[model samples]
Target: MDEEVIARYLARRDAIDQSVDLVVLMGSAVLESVEVAAEAHRTYAAPILISGGIGHSTHYLEGAVRRRDCRSRWIGRSRTSFAIC
Candidate 1:
């Protein structure tokens, strides 16, 4: 996971409130990225929308698998508001 990217995203999200009703994140790493984003969104009170489809080949497959794994881990956690797709 890229902490820098996550931190930047969090900082940006923190700059707004209610202004954003939903946030959509793409990419296989979305699961982890969303987790970090969700934490930041908690402070601003925003809902999240996670999106990722099966990959085209092996590389994509790997990403999808990792994302799925992360998603499973996030399943039972309670937070401000979020969703996985």
Candidate 2:
């Protein structure tokens, strides 16, 4: 890729970061995502949503967050509790 093109892409990414309403963490960055969500919650009081099952690391991440008493409701997969009313 050209240097100018890469720079443009990075600039666009920064723009998106500035305008995003919610941040989701997944894949290999789950741990980092947890910390970001928690801190963002403290600073902005914005809701954070986390979902997984893409790989084996999801379970470990979920456990870590639970151990820390992270306040979040689990949705999707086997954690959901919704009725089609």
Candidate 3:
């Protein structure tokens, strides 16, 4: 990765608020992304709005739920809501 890109990414990441009213988890292929969002929700007691369709990350999402041993039950289609265990 370029130094400039890394710097910009770190800067934006460091600017995030410690707590928020909501956590919008756009779909990602990485389990760590989901874990982070889940942690945010737990820490903030905020509702997570799961945007984006499953797309190509179906297996990744399922694997994450299993690996984390979370009974993730999605409610609704298109934009959904779920809570991690």
Whole-model lDDT per candidate = 0.54, 0.50, 0.65
Best by lDDT: 3
5-60 per-residue lDDT for model 2 (tens digits): 98577435222334446665443423554555567666655676655544666466
The digit string of per-residue lDDT tens for model 3 on 1-85 reads: 6999985774354445666889887776455667787878887899988776656776777677667765545444232344445
RMSD to the hidden true structure, all candidates: 8.3, 9.3, 5.4
| TM-scores of all predicted structures | 0.39, 0.37, 0.51
lDDT for 28 (candidate 1): 49
Off by over 4 Å in 1: 1-14, 30-32, 56-85
Best-performing candidate as measured by TM-score: 3
List the pairs of residues colliding in candidate 1: none
Cα deviation of 41 in candidate 2 (Å)?
1.6
Models ranked on lDDT:
3, 1, 2
Ranking by TM-score: 3, 1, 2
- Evaluated at residue 41, the lDDT of candidate 2 is 61
Clashes of each: 0, 0, 0
